[model samples]
Target chain A: MTTDALALPMAVPAAGLPARVRIHEVGARDGLQNEKATVPTEVKAEFVRRLADAGLTTIEATSFVRPEWVPQLADAERLYPLVAGLPVALPVLVPNERGLDRALRLGARRVAVFASATESFAKANLNRTVDEALAMFEPVVARAKAEGVHVRGYLSMCFGDPWEGPVPLPRVVRVCRALLDQGCDELSLGDTIGVATPGHVTALLAALEEAGVPVSALGVHFHDTYGQALANTLAALQHGVTTVDASAGGLGGCPYAKSATGNLATEDLVWMLRGLGIDTGVDLGRLVATSVWMAERLGRPSPSRTVRALAPTVASPASHKEQ
Target chain B: MTTDALALPMAVPAAGLPARVRIHEVGARDGLQNEKATVPTEVKAEFVRRLADAGLTTIEATSFVRPEWVPQLADAERLYPLVAGLPVALPVLVPNERGLDRALRLGARRVAVFASATESFAKANLNRTVDEALAMFEPVVARAKAEGVHVRGYLSMCFGDPWEGPVPLPRVVRVCRALLDQGCDELSLGDTIGVATPGHVTALLAALEEAGVPVSALGVHFHDTYGQALANTLAALQHGVTTVDASAGGLGGCPYAKSATGNLATEDLVWMLRGLGIDTGVDLGRLVATSVWMAERLGRPSPSRTVRALAPTVASPASHKEQ
Candidate 1:
């Protein structure tokens, strides 16, 4: 690479932000799940390894959903053991007790459960009411805690819902409180449709804090549908959120939402974090290279502005291959 | 368009931000100047008219640089007359006294002179030393002000430069003060390389404030090359900047910098501003339609994430044409 190709942002620290941020990389699981084509099991394994090698400490490996439900992640049983020995944290998604049981049998130490703040998504995604979905997750969280596995609860539609217009702050707070009450270690507040603005993010964080949920246990998962993810992430960081969920190369869109875009790109987030003088322990060049490779494999360019700008030659051509 | 295609962000106001912002639209001038294909004069005129109809108060029409220098906008004389009847502020760029004379002859009321923060960009872009470029702009600003015309000074490379790395705060302050001292009414700080982060944005704004430059007279022009523009714009807004410069469809990339990307998309900026309950008087649907129309003329998909997510059916197919 030329010196120009590897140009990094100059460090200039902002006040009222954490000194270091922990990025929960979700490309292998949340990202690939939404792809039209199912990737091979080994490619998924190698993707996780590359993310870890790029200095990401927490990588969500794959979902333990029933193979028929989400066929893309059906190889969870086969995929978990391939990278179980990596030094980084690999959190797999577990839909219920069955999913958790399958994950634990493969020696997975970290797991996440998906929940919804809106009732419509709960019914559609889980085939159960919001309360019933929580009840289904009750035993999964308990069992994961009992086995000393770290658990993360993903609360979707925290900002807006398609069927329901704007979700009330109190309604979202209730779901977040319930997840915490169920012994989940961390909560990732998701903007499933990417309709969130900075003020909305700050308001939600404040509401959660008032409900006695500490900022330390909260992470933000934003999509870029309206191009508000990075701005919203900035608001969350200023509100003391240190754990950010991002997908390498901005990999996936919400499978349920019609207008949803991909998750906040990891490389985009890293560029901002590095510029703020916040240490993410990520090597951006390696991360961009990895995203380029993944985009080539996916036969489409990464939907990441940072990835495209940094690796223009490789990224621009991938779009041609899509034709 | 279906109601789903017209999905708008729910308004939630943030604390300490201006109630309304003035968007200085630059797609006609700064945006198209970098395009390899020369957009027809009538098409450029229509883009401006559509922007005005969409509630943009200020639209940059075109530059008055030597025709040979910017062949894409070589028909500036023919273009200005076509859009001059629009009831909006059309600020055209004037490089020096000669360019200023041409704009004045065309009855241009508002004109902007380009200045650079670093010595390298000063030499590369203007082919003059930093002071020499300022010397050339001094007469143009005085002449325009003396004729009761509005003058804006564009200071490029405010954050970082390609030839020289991170630009120092004092150097930027010096050039800004020079432009203001030369009778320029407003200053647009350009992050030409898109390497700026929020802290750096806040720091620069604070420094400019300390140098007796009010936030009211300052505008921010950010590129999304590194995906930092919106986050940085949020920082500037928090620091009380009320004017922002954006292209209609994330239209232009820096011709001087190899790794640069387009300016922040006006649609992306409007999405965040509207979501924050900050009014720009812009109709998002009309704006998206306008960008979509322009992107078709350019024969490329807009770099704006909001445009792609909202107009997926129209935008996704444009890539096939590239092949």
Candidate 2:
């Protein structure tokens, strides 16, 4: 580039950065669901409580899917009552009519449905085609909306699919629009295989707008499998995405994606947002503590860099970004 | 942000991304220096050869500091003449006039000098004050320049110092200008503790330009301690930087910065740059293979995410971005 071009204002100006961002904590549901060990119901309860206490206003408490499908989260029925009283919007994942029935019976105030932007992922994850899966979620979202329950829609493999190398932009936009059209309040675009770069993110967000989806109604869920999650998040934020989905402690990647690793860690995201002078409301120190405690239950150290840098044994803790 | 704001172009337009980036491979020098085990002279020679074969044109071969200071690169004289015939720039680190004398006797074509942005880091790292260290290097740079050898200057802890919280911008800018004014061809700003985010990088680059330092003479060396390396690199590239410093397989972090982990992996950088259509002329497959091979020699798996996802054990390598 010419020296003159470098002097021009950067495309991602500080003014384009979001002032306040809402983090949707998905560790309780998405993170624990992928773990080999069945996290104790009390442990799950405490995780949600800690997440809410750490200032995560939208905490996905549990998934109401069947025990046969994901046995790890089979205790959702017992876990829901534990965190239902917290001063947070606890959204539980509801897969079908059966999952929605379970949530409605438990007086779930908020629920989320997962849709696939790729055909193979829909078949492998939902045992149905993409259209059939969306058709199945329509009534669940409509009924939940009728009962005064808010709904969120997650479109998996938005950027790249495990089966399809790169999901077409129109495929993601179609699924996102269908979810929002069917009464879902917000849609999160997921890069299931974690193959997205910033350019793909910006272009996809632009295409979603071209499809008539409002920017405020869209959030981004990126996996750190390729180390692009935070960078992609910055790109999305630059393009006006105010809501972001993060797993506390970099908890979960899609179990169905097989090769995908952890989600973007909330601590890592909070660190960047704080440095950018954006408000995330969540306390970073408290968030790292929560992840460290959860990692102990799994008998492993947290994979989060922020958590690693701030852990008790880390010297010069006073100089760390968290401190 | 409003829906209308989303319609606006992203801050980093695709056209603004760099078309070609130079990869300054630092694995042989910086990577092995931090390693606990001493690599043999022959192994270091083979490593440099493989890096050049993988299309890295500028590979930092070794450090010419006192043997007692860094025993890892103690065979600099033997190692230099070994790969001196390769089609690459082998720039060894010359700490002072004594080191410059050693390089001059050995017919070194390119050399680099180190400076510190903070006084605490200077004393801690170089056992000298910032000005003292610069004064010590001015002669080395002048001697190297007199011999028609290209010199590159490195300013460490430019963003955040472990002892000092955040190094002031002017402090970094002043050191940077001093280095460039002393006849160094390029200045590589080093985030020794790696706490910088994209916003800080943007502001610093802008500040440097305002202080009359052209972006053409700048390169960036970021550590992945906080997982912001790739994001910060994107911000730098958007600001028109065509040169980046990365270690193969994410090899090294400062041994002094207890919290810092791996250097930004060249494979990871290539993955993102390739996705953004930026060319760095490095064969990522060969690079990952080289890293995996080096990891075997070091008796550990690489810390790079791209390497982990593209390793032989990974199930779905076909859909991987690296492949």
Candidate 1 regions with alpha-carbon error over 4 angstroms: A1-6, A312-323, B1-6, B312-323
Residues A71-109, candidate 1: write the lDDT tens digits.
Answer: 999899889899999999999999998899899999999
On a 0 to 100 scale, what is the lDDT of residue B185 in model 2? 96
Report how far residue A123 has shifted in candidate 2, in Å: 0.6
Question: What DockQ do you compute for every candidate structure?
Answer: 0.49, 0.25
Computed on C-alpha atoms, the DockQ of candidate 1 is 0.49
Residue A203 displacement in candidate 1 (angstroms): 0.5
TM-score of chain A of each: 0.95, 0.92
Least accurate stretch of 10 residues (summed lDDT) in model 1 chain B?
Answer: B314-323
For model 2, state the Cα shift of residue B312 in Å: 1.5
Question: Which residues of candidate 2, in runs, are more than 4 Å off?
Answer: A1-13, A313-323, B1-13, B313-323
Question: What is the Cα-based TM-score of model 2?
Answer: 0.93
